[model samples]
Target chain A: MLETGRLDHNLGRMGERARALGVRLRPHLKTAKSYDVARLATAGEFGGITVSTLAEAEYFLAGGITDLLYAVGIVPSKLPRAARLVEAGAHLTLILDSVETARAVAAFADLRRVAFAVLIEIDTGEGRSGVLPEAADLVEIGTALEQPPYCRLQGVITHAGHSYAARDLETVARIAEAERSGAVRAAERLRAAGLSVPVVSVGSTPTALHARHLSGVTELRAGVYMFGDLFQAQIGSCTLDDLAVSVLATVTGHHRDAGHLLIDAGALALSKDRSTADAPHDYGFGLLVHADGTPFAQELRIFKVYQEHGLVRAADGALPFDELPIGAQVRVLPNHVCMTAAMYDRYHLVKNGALAGEWTRTNGW
Target chain B: MLETGRLDHNLGRMGERARALGVRLRPHLKTAKSYDVARLATAGEFGGITVSTLAEAEYFLAGGITDLLYAVGIVPSKLPRAARLVEAGAHLTLILDSVETARAVAAFADLRRVAFAVLIEIDTGEGRSGVLPEAADLVEIGTALEQPPYCRLQGVITHAGHSYAARDLETVARIAEAERSGAVRAAERLRAAGLSVPVVSVGSTPTALHARHLSGVTELRAGVYMFGDLFQAQIGSCTLDDLAVSVLATVTGHHRDAGHLLIDAGALALSKDRSTADAPHDYGFGLLVHADGTPFAQELRIFKVYQEHGLVRAADGALPFDELPIGAQVRVLPNHVCMTAAMYDRYHLVKNGALAGEWTRTNGW
Candidate 1:
């Protein structure tokens, strides 16, 4: 077994923070990727978790973790799997943005003869998936699906993912405001239309942390906060101190001529997700840190990656690169922790920079 | 068992035509994330398999899919795993660009009593991971590592991954030519220095299919052929028919105001790899096809995605989207097949749109 290198208080801290924030923390499991992390997230009062993949829902649901939300846009290819999860007695909630999905999901419910709770995805500002802020018919149609007596419309949810691309915290705050308002608006519209809207939710690591107050929001869905990434640091979501996750990479090479160091963490380990803004910063895949988690002064990156090798470029711009000793182990702060983390299968947990326990990541459909 | 949907052999057959043209085929396994597909590529006379993740290498190698080349740049975080693979007696080759990696590998080999064969990465014209065309001494130093002798310096490998962002087919082809020629030139210079460099490798799916000849190229590395994504079609690398892989999704809802369809595939299922290049045709997140494998003239995208829902926009630009009935199954062609395939734990094999068998995807650090 890979030795668990550190003790992690991320889940415990996140759960406590969620309680302090006054919202039901359905912590998105897409970030931690570890069953132990999810378990920790649920150990206190946050008994429910949010999952991005069906496999994650299944894994957590089977590992004695319950109150699951399969929080992807609902489609038909995975309805059977979703139905199976529901059949296995998972309090599974799925999200949808259209009527086509309603019909498909209803069909699955009819075939399986099980009732399902689904959230209507409303686009507050993220502009990814959801009904528009003005689209009341989306709610009507979704609530009308309750006529089927099998598919139940639970409430509405939105993700302020656009907060990640925020120019500053103010923009992130505005996006957060819009997201909660949007979910509240949809929920109110449903209630005004005489439908029971129980859950009003909004999420995003940025929005969740800085949304100010829950107000109309009953559930806060946020991932990636548990493991801070380079993008997170740039947006001022958390300081380098709060970054709970990083790829434990080994320094494999030194380019003496270029004054560059090569690492094993490449686009595969560190995802290819660069900041999607016009003025992208030079956090090469992530901040390359020393093994003890102290920041490495050299502005370095596992930039220019190939299938296996990371072309580490020093931002300090020295030449004849050979500085790092061979066989030194390093940690890479991923550009986007969510995407980078989704690439790995398990986490070598480190608590206070000491070996903790192994936390296996879930591979959800 | 998910169906192994049947694909028209037209595109895969074109791959055969490329083989006839003397362009050696070495398919990358990052796409599809399946061993069955790897076996098929071998059956298709794909010379060798290129892997981005060590999990893939372990899976293919253990499954008797030897002759594996981990296409990513080698880093230290994974050397122990490499040693394990070597100890298991798999003929694996690693890639790197700097002497630091060489020294690290050498030290690790010395400590572990394992010999790792490594290739010096070259930055052809792509400006990715690689030694410059003039870095001969660096290669000498790496090749001359005598202590503990952890790694053996093989030849050189380069990928014109940036070729994917080319303007047109001609530019892509030109980049492809430069990619192979640059590696060949570097290898020749190394050989002139009395270095016994054997492998002169080059690749990138776009460059692999477009290049006229390997010339001095000893091996060709290509992935994404088994599943031609929307990006490949944009670059004119392969036709829609050659796309062998897709996320079989179910329609979950309809966005009436935006004429959008909601799907079950979110970023977790489809991945977030938007091809760097803009395509000639408007292919959304993926090409939405009927179960029969025929595509519609209408262009649709899983445009705005939430955790569980994929918001698909219709080409018609009209909301109240009426044609697509609920409870229908659709195949989502990915923006990039490799990353998308990695999201799933297994391929629900489909042949002729009928259930074939479940081929599990392997995973680990």
Candidate 2:
């Protein structure tokens, strides 16, 4: 179920978009968090995987995946894991933005006589984790890595996470272009300093889809595109039909007085991730769907979430909950499918309305 | 650690309060989401347990723990799992507000002879789930067990989740009284109908702590007390020291431009569950703690969360963040400990500044 239906479509579209952009599609596995889904993603394609966790990279490597990028910047406490990945002969790229990190990685790798690929993250106007675009010293520090004991400077990557706040697709497009241009400019600045920037990466599912024409961006690293969620749908990146995952739930009780039906799948099952709530259509928890993959009537909306119960409210503040039986099974399309999927250790796949299989997930540092 | 310093103390006090009110505390297990901590809680003299998911209940029961209540109102899709619990000789209490569910459970249980201690969920105004207290027909429906082939009714229960919004202890106390009175009144109505109402339960962590007496309340359910978080603390309910568990993360990168350090712990590690953000001193994500569990320096705040990256904003707001050496391990106190812990497959116990044993968890339905 992890690699079914719209998942394949999304994966194909991402690859196609990458080809059209003349860049490598470095789809991060942190989105699906499923080995089966990752396998489908890499199947028959020259895919360079990006992972936020060492466990994910290790999972892919164990499955014969060689090209991988530990995209979430590495810290000193888990440097040993990064060194191990490089030692295991996996083509690993590490993300870092500080001279202190560079010095530490260099010292550790020098001791092991193994040089690793490192990318200095650049902040492209997004006040999140990254070095300032004008901070050329940060890039120079990466390039100054000691050969035997240090990491080799790769290119730079930027994630315009704030692009989701754009009011329209036009603004999102502008943000995407600016994000790509920023990373490219940083890479150009490094190249002028005589360093060969191998990979210029840009992220954020919204920006990636919109910035396919941004030429200087060598590789597109986007997760969550595999599972179009309320976030993606809200940003005008995908339609509801594009979503590949949904939380399976059951109607527990009906409030005939207030007009709502309680469901077993609440925040516990659906996750309390409301990252996309800022979007125009901010459903609190998720959109309720019938068991057959079709969404329920528009009258029903999951408006409130408790630790273990979801309150389905009607559009007009009255629950027409009589439409659902007390025991009917339903699927809830969560606010952020990436966070929602991460909550579960496995995915229960349904294809043609039949239980296909269970695809397990791995999680750790 | 589920049973940590300040949170342990708070839960202890709340338990005492509940016991004094003549309500046996069957605290929900969904909050802390740890068996070791829960076992420790039970060892401290809890009478029964309330679980949101059957998976949790099964995990506890298989470990020789019993007296369980599947508190998230009964749904038809999960009837078989509930029946299985009854078949295993576990004293199970099921919650549902509708006769439709009662009839369904009755039909399913009649065959298994699964005599369930069903609790008629009364809506005492938190309004997430349950029948309204004035829905007098609900009591008749519960006592109408002879009309069904499925399950038996035990009594009534209500959760005043809205008490969380109280501005002070006085408001929390008032809400608690109302909640207790509402459930008691419903039970009275049931008794007036010649129905033998065995248990009249009402609770919420805030109410359980502030309310002096339960009046006619027989049982208490409070989960978050075991591992209180920022949201709890913000309601003047718990303090910073009371946060039991935190996601121990590694400092991966520092955003100099944003004056923030990046940690591996993000929304995926620490849940985005901020129910009381409308309150004063609404902490974002959660407060960060040092290795020894003391709060991080005032300059450091976990301001924003990506899927797997916590942007630790520095107080100075400087773009020259190259000070912190990479690889520093930091522990992040979560917004809601229970939901955050649920995202992880296991717990890495940090006791006396060292990694202790690993505690595994069961996921899914």
Candidate 3:
């Protein structure tokens, strides 16, 4: 859960950043899969929301967020579902990194006599998805989408997911620059091939925050910035206090000999992300905080976790077990807010140390 | 999803094994969180069921699984909910690993005027929860539960979770024996103190599968075997072919340069449980299979995953790219079924190459 004040602050910061950078902020709604948060994030508009699944696309579309980008690679089997969203008056956009998927999208659109807007995904050094920006495959995919009456190349989108592994700002900025340049170059190539690649998008929380400028980028897409996590904090994207989301858990037991406190939150509650394992500050699973979402003791962390039990202890062995007795409620700042938040069905919102409201979120594909 | 025939085989094997060991099979419904599966696992009896959460307890109770044991350590805040289940004619059994919790349960029962059946969780080397068998704390917890008219000392329960880390059958057997002996010893100590400790429960998927004997153990509570995973297969608990649960994914794209196939299933669909990282066979995130759940390639696996994209590649550089083309359906044998299944609302069942049924599941805390 997050305090509305802090959440607003986080959202305001990102919104301001997008304004200053002169790019449309198409916030990815995958992280905070809540209609309430999305409404606040997009400032209550259908203005270009990004989704990772068709489920999310449908969810947000039903909530009146009709302008959606199903950001993952589009497959033929899922074309009908994506088409249904488009049929329901959603300006849905599909992305693909391969010509095969592009052809499939073309075929599906041709068969169904439906117009489909698509983006060519560029590999901006992530080595995970997309075609290399300089590769001939990028032009091939763009050409494949451009050849039909039903298919049109909307733009090129790239994600610098590798930016999270950057240890310093200079590296993050460099990766961000690469991400921006790669997507821009791919878009340029598509334009050179006589295709109207209208939109250019690039982002990842670290890269989005560290990018000096958005030269050819038209819109910024980032999700985790709204709910900063320990991984982002360790990477210098956000401060520890900037983290908005925290899992409220009850202390189940205390082991005097082992010098630890056990909480109800575990792998199921906090998730076994461990994204901070190689970071500067390794919060074992998550950092322990007061019920009001402040650090309880210096360097306290959840050192271990089972399916339903989290073993909390001081990192430097200062031993705060006596203070955190059984039945104590503590908030755990997650290592990855996206994964942690996926476990809970709703958010128990707090504002200035008081229960404000509860917001329900959707999950699964 | 699982093939019904394979699931039946897995369930029947475990049931037969429990019968052969001369113990009651109290199948833990933590893995398969479906009423359809639970009914089949328990063979249509409210005799006993082990759950990891109160959500499961309430869910099963609604479906007539009355005899339930919450395996997680009981906390004071959760007592009212557990008491409600008991009040609703559920023969619920509560477990506590601490004297403070035992006293809290006693107080809750005493105040409510309800006699609660309680078990002292014994640490059979898992150390995650439970009192050590030889420790005075075990007897102390038992003594606290023995107070008249409030709580009755049911017995002791231990889980050999350490058995998962065991590399050999002998080690797993030894851990299973330790689990049995530690729990039996705790029960014996309670009996020595004139407490009528009636039951001794112990299990873990690996331990339950390999245990040669259960001399004094009254019941074995094991989950995951009903939906065997790669970690269990790597630990030699079950063969790879015996795994029942798998994520049905569609190949969204194929990157020729990267020599990998991208699937729609990623962290959200398959979950990010890297439990087999240190195992003999590191199946990456999960092993790739055909539409009918047969291995596509001998060593093909989902190498890396994003939020909604899975990068699947052959481990030995023998790519099967052409075989698994775009839009092709594939089943991924999960690293851990419990974590993977937690993401989906229902299991897409297949029996003998046909869609049999879809079983809905319970999730969240």
lDDT (CA) for every model shown? 0.71, 0.76, 0.87
Model 3 lDDT, residue A306, Cα: 81
- In model 1 chain B, the worst 10-residue window by lDDT is B1-10
TM-score of chain A of 3: 0.97
Considering only chain B, report the TM-score of each candidate against the true chain B.
0.89, 0.92, 0.97
For model 3, name the residue pairs that clash.
Answer: none
Per-residue CA lDDT of candidate 1, range A110-229, in tens?
A: 778877888888888765567876784676556555745678888888888888778687888888888888889888888877888889988888887777677877898877777776
* Local accuracy of candidate 3 as per-residue lDDT tens digits, B1-365: 77888889998988888888989989999889899999899883336899999999999999988999999888898999988998887888998888888888888899987768998888889877778888877778888898777688899989989898999999999998889888888888888888888899999888888999998999999999998999999999889889988998898877777778788888878878999998998998999888888775468898888888899888886677778788889889999888888888898898888998799999987
Which parts of model 2 are misplaced by more than 4 Å?
A1-3, A146-150, A297-299, A316-319, B1-8, B44-46, B146-150, B296-299, B314-325, B350-356
Which has the greatest lDDT? 3
Clashes of each: 74, 17, 0
- Given candidate 2, what's the lDDT at residue A186? 88
**Which of 2 and 3 is the better model by TM-score?**
3
lDDT of 2 at B163: 91
Give per-residue CA lDDT, model 2, range B1-365, as digits (tens): 43344545766787777668776877777765557667766765655888878888888888777889888777766777877877787888887777766777677677677777788888788877777778857765776553343465678889999998888898898988889988998888888888778898777788888887877878888888877777888887778877767777777775543456777788877878775467776567776666567764563667788878887765445522454445666677777776777777776666555666777766666
- What would the TM-scores of all predictions be? 0.82, 0.94, 0.98
Model 2's DockQ score: 0.70
CAPRI grade, predicted model 1: acceptable
Listed for each candidate, the true contacts retained, as a fraction, are 0.48, 0.89, 0.58
Worst 10 residues of 3 chain A by lDDT: A44-53
